[model samples]
Target: MTNHIVERASARLNESTLLEMFWGMLLSRRLDERAWALHRQGKIHFHISGMGHEAAQVGTAFALNRGVDYIHPYYRDLALSLAVGITPTDFMMSLFGRKDEYSSGGRQMPSHFSSKDKHIISGSSPVATQVPQAAGLAFAIQYRQKCGLVDPNDTSQPRLALACLGEGSTSQGEWHEGMNWAGVHKLPFICLVQNNIYAISVPLESQMAVANVADRATAYGVAGVVVDGNDVLAVYDVMVQAVQRAYSGGGATLVEAKTYRPVPHSSDDDDRSYRSREEVAEWKKKDPIMRFQNSLLEDGILNDSLLHDYESRARAEVDKAQADAEAAPLPDAEEVFGSVYAPLEEQP
Candidate 1:
């Protein structure tokens, strides 16, 4: 299907909401940038840069209702997590493997964010694990609404669950299982495929024959859209439509955001071995942060001075959060048993 294009100007949206979304993107960018720098300094063990993904992440966050809606985010979704109110300190704590880290209490490796209160489900290192979990949550929402468990008369909407992952994850068995089940049941779920061109060292073209990730939606009989992930306004408009569809019982929609990773897959992998430096440099020119900022400037919604101030504040906040996280205590060996499960009684 042909994509319905939206203007790249933020002025087209509600002014206050547009500003909020812009600020959210800026904050997310700053957090990710600081984390990457910390990794280089050896203060944090590893990091993933969301440099070319701020638009999609911020747009999706603005479209959804935080705490009300469920979000099953992938490892490369630090910007989305932070944009949805996962604090810089919380992220730093996780990066530093401190006891106060909300996701896994420092047990999980860095970049896997999870929070019950924020409705951001815990991330797994395994690919596509959150896909089925998101579908299940959407099913439960429908069940609750049908059973009159929630306000039936309101008709405002039932909550939705978003399962977001990289395009490479689409090749995983769990991805098919989750999409198939949700599509069969006509559940209110949204699957966001961030096609950053490469899945580790492999490109999307090598993984699938389809022209675009959205084309896979044809098998499921749902609306599909492919958008420029670097365009924040375009992404926001598309996500708003998807959110409306799911909430209105229009069923699941699969969105493929065409973007770039702009960095190695992770701290361990070296893309320079398999990918060309020229390709990386070319993608840097269309960097999501620069693109989104340009859009805001074009719309006359933000000046360079304001943008600089926001950047400065973001940097300061990240530094302070890192300091706090670094100073926090690590978990004791005995404390590990407290979180596993309830104690069992001894047999007679």
Candidate 2:
């Protein structure tokens, strides 16, 4: 059933692109597994698993303008960051809180990824904050267009803001406020709700009344869509349309990706308490990485030998990253206040 759908979609993307997607998903899964192991071994203070969300993250990332489009991603977007050029070493440095860690200079928690070079906005601990911030960025992009800073008429250059959040964050007032503003102003914003069934220990039914999170977009008069988040190709297709609409001045879009959280909410939580083993096992049957790999093999894009080689290479890369990060020094206490503010004279 799944193979047929993936096969049809595989034809749309070139073999190299599809292979890249597979590699990202594979690397993310292996990295996530290592993080979990590191947490258990007391090597890391905390860990957030992005085990089941790779397809949606990587797929959406591939659909965007790599160096141009801005992305405001939540913590569990490891695959998304990788697809956007955040290396395994960068993640490891952040995981170990090394002084040279690119994200926050080792100040913030791991997974709060930010890179100016990659067009990724710094994320915060507070949930749903990025929603309004995304709207503001979209507005800024439009402002730049009006000021002739960017050519809006250039169809080739489509600058958009992608705001990603968990479905649980939709309950926050900021989500609604952001959506309302984007809708009214017709901002080039794409709200991606990674609905991973469970918001920590709480299930989707406990938090929202609606069956689909995308339905909330109707209130703001924006295009809302629900896609199989596990299906990488499906996500890519949807994002392509959403990006096109935003670029052409249509309006904002809310994409609800229906996926599952296979691991615990974080390293601190226990999933066995809230969910049954059977349920988790059932979801594993529909594992995104395995599904994609199967399609690739069936389509002759990949083989067993190549799959084995890819896995080995990914693991070795992660191994080197961990070693390098472990050998690096911690952040200096005296420089704690460095990035807090600019000179008073330079302040606005």
Candidate 3:
């Protein structure tokens, strides 16, 4: 939470890792902008963005076992999905509600990310619902290890469950119950609170009395931590600690990443009424992508040529994904309830 603390936790990141992080951040930004463009053109019905939260999400994602750990990501987690190996094509398919998309097969709303190979659990609209689901999954992992179905001695990949949400969801009963349950059982769980200071339209102060969401972790008996969400390196450093602790059977942790959302909550909401243009502009100057780019330049890891190449690649990737999704077919009305019920032979 403090500058001194951050320096102490900071790890020496190599050039390769730094470049990988930059590429991930770039991919996320390109896809996010394309989504907004589609929405403005009336090509999509609704869109929620993760513009200001890229550093926090991408940094946390790099610390996990990419496809092995179970991740339950909330809405506004487009960056998180992309960072964790969910292809731009998969994201576009879901945004367009295409029939072949793996996440709900175009039945559910967009931003509910899911991938069978990646082990990403599809999220719902109800706030904090994934909190309990993540905890339950952690319990299942614990049971599997205990039953010898999963190797507890496997140090290469210590499985865990991650629950991601906005700071506002911390007030929900499900959030409290889930965190408490995990703490009681010492489940290998991590609760990531991307604190962007608002619950739809309500400010952080109005929604909760505490100064920081991480402050409540004490009551749950889990380790509480806060970090600069805009600083990718800082967030990654802290996540390294949390992941190691979980792998070493250190139980659960609550990470409150302080961030800000510069865009409107969604296409349906007008941000002008609730926030000031000056405030948004001020936050824009602290854009995580630019800040990281500056750092890379200073470290000699990025140059004008490399920057241009990365940008061009990212744009092309997004362009191809958009074309693919737009050309794909939508779900059929005849199969509205296709996967809802089991067939007679499979039904007990």
TM-score per model over all chains = 0.93, 0.95, 0.95
Give the better candidate number (1 or 2) by TM-score: 2
Q: lDDT tens digits, residues 173-291, model 3?
A: 99999999889988889999999997878999898988989998889989889988998888888788888777778888899999999889988888888888998899999899999
Per-residue lDDT tens digits of candidate 2, residues 1-348?
Answer: 011222444357999999999999999999989999999999999998888999999889988898578899999999999999998889999999999699889988999999988889999978999999999999998888878987986644548999999999999999999999999999999999999988898899998999999988888989998989999998888888888778888989999999998899999999999999999999999999999999899999999999999999998999998998899999898768786776788867
RMSD of each: 3.2, 3.1, 2.2
The Cα RMSD of model 3 versus the native structure comes to 2.2
Q: All candidates' lDDT scores?
A: 0.83, 0.90, 0.87
Better candidate by lDDT, 1 or 2 = 2
Worst 10 residues of 1 by lDDT: 2-11
Strongest candidate by lDDT: 2
